[model samples]
Target: MAETTNGDARGASEQGAGEATNPQQFTIQKIYLKDSSVETPGAPEVFTQSWKPEARVELNTRRNTVGEGLYEVVLTVTVTATVEERTAYLCEVHQAGLFTVAGFESNATDQLLGAYCPGVLFPYAREAVSDLTGKAGFPPMTLSPVNFDALYARQRQREAASAESADDQETDNPG
Candidate 1:
């Protein structure tokens, strides 16, 4: 136990020294709901039908650099519910966060902006969706938790595959 404690202390000291050379920083300046919209196109008539509504949910994430070492990440969630051929309710929420990240490699920063930051913002977006739906005279739409890391990995894989295919085509045809 004592050896483990000493080793941990040594590791901490080493990391501290490393941080001094290239200081790493990460902070969330603010998290807010950037935009939201709820529409109930078919109100009284749609509610009269059986409560069997087909719900479709779409989610997307985007990031942009606001300033040096500062970035804005937005998670957009859209939900539409329809009863038979009639529209029930449509809700959209854009949850955004301002993050400051420095001293990290490009890939790390991308991961932070794509996955980690969005992961932090997702719950708020989900809650907003549910709240909006409930307030629109419908049952709360409880959204399932998202696996941002897995989604990011899949997206990266698809991009890499596309690039490889483009490179292969170029090599095959030299015009």
Candidate 2:
């Protein structure tokens, strides 16, 4: 918390000229499971086979602005378990949250929504996936923690590289 020493009402606004007076803030208003599903096509047949199965995991994130300084971020996770080329089970979960973000520059805001918000939502999404797997009468499965910051950085790097390549191609062959 930051406190202003000046008591006068006008003193606050007079402190900074041509600058944003509001402090940066990021808050979570709500977190919930937007959607979830689990499938076991092999079912009883799968139970008869070996318990050793290979697991595949996928993750995605997206955001939308709903109001002034308010955003909705959704993290989707999918898991597929297979044994000997046969599908044991599949699961998908959409974990979503409403956040209030203010007093940040465009890039900072993007980082918050892209990396920080998804990080906050991941534990819930993991729990949902675990619950889904357990309810399907399979072993309790727990997903490893993800490094969203690294992922976001890599994505930004890829985008920058592609843009730079496009510019280079244009420079080489101007039409």
Candidate 3:
């Protein structure tokens, strides 16, 4: 006859127990503006005259592991407006988010950190920058859509090409 006891049942339960897990484990640890700055050196006087101002935007992204499974993603955007050599406004915003990312593959993690995370945080940063610029006496500067995935891919390609060139140089020298 088979043994029927609490110990056996407990052992069976332990053997058949699924891995400890929770569906709601992943979460956004926190979201904050890491850094932000807006400058309008030529504000009142700069905006007084009728001059076509040109705007330039530069963006950069960085990611760092904060904990065992937590990561921080930061997106930095710099916007500058100039009217024929005179500076109208300059704005820099750094938006950051802390996310708990467990059980994610490297590619997926990279995609989240590189593209999706930034996409989620950019709107708030844009709004803050626009408000700052407007409050600085310049017209509200609306940022355009950014294809972060394409940008990330382009950056990777450039890095790979540079590495290949470096490797080719090393191979040719063989010194």
Against the true structure, whose lDDT is highest? 1
Residue-wise lDDT of candidate 2 within 1-175, one digit each (tens)? 1344545545656765435556788899999999999999988999998799999999999999999999999999999999988999999999999999999999999999999999999999999999999999999679999999999999999999999999999999999
Clashing pairs in 2: none
Q: TM-score for model 2?
A: 0.88
lDDT of 3: 0.84
lDDT of 3 by residue, 1-175 (tens): 2556877987877766643443223567888999999887886788678868999999888989998878899989899999878888889999899988777777777777888888878888888788888888777888998888888789879989999999999999999
Top model by TM-score, which number?
2
Model 1 per-residue lDDT tens digits across residues 57-102: 9989998899999999999999999998778999999999999999
Query: Which has the better TM-score: candidate 2, or candidate 3?
Result: 2
Off by over 4 Å in 2: 1-22
Assess the local accuracy of residue 21 in candidate 1 as a C-alpha lDDT between 0 and 100. Answer: 88
Residue 162 shift from truth in candidate 2, angstroms: 1.2
Which runs in model 1 stand beyond 4 Å of their true positions?
1-22
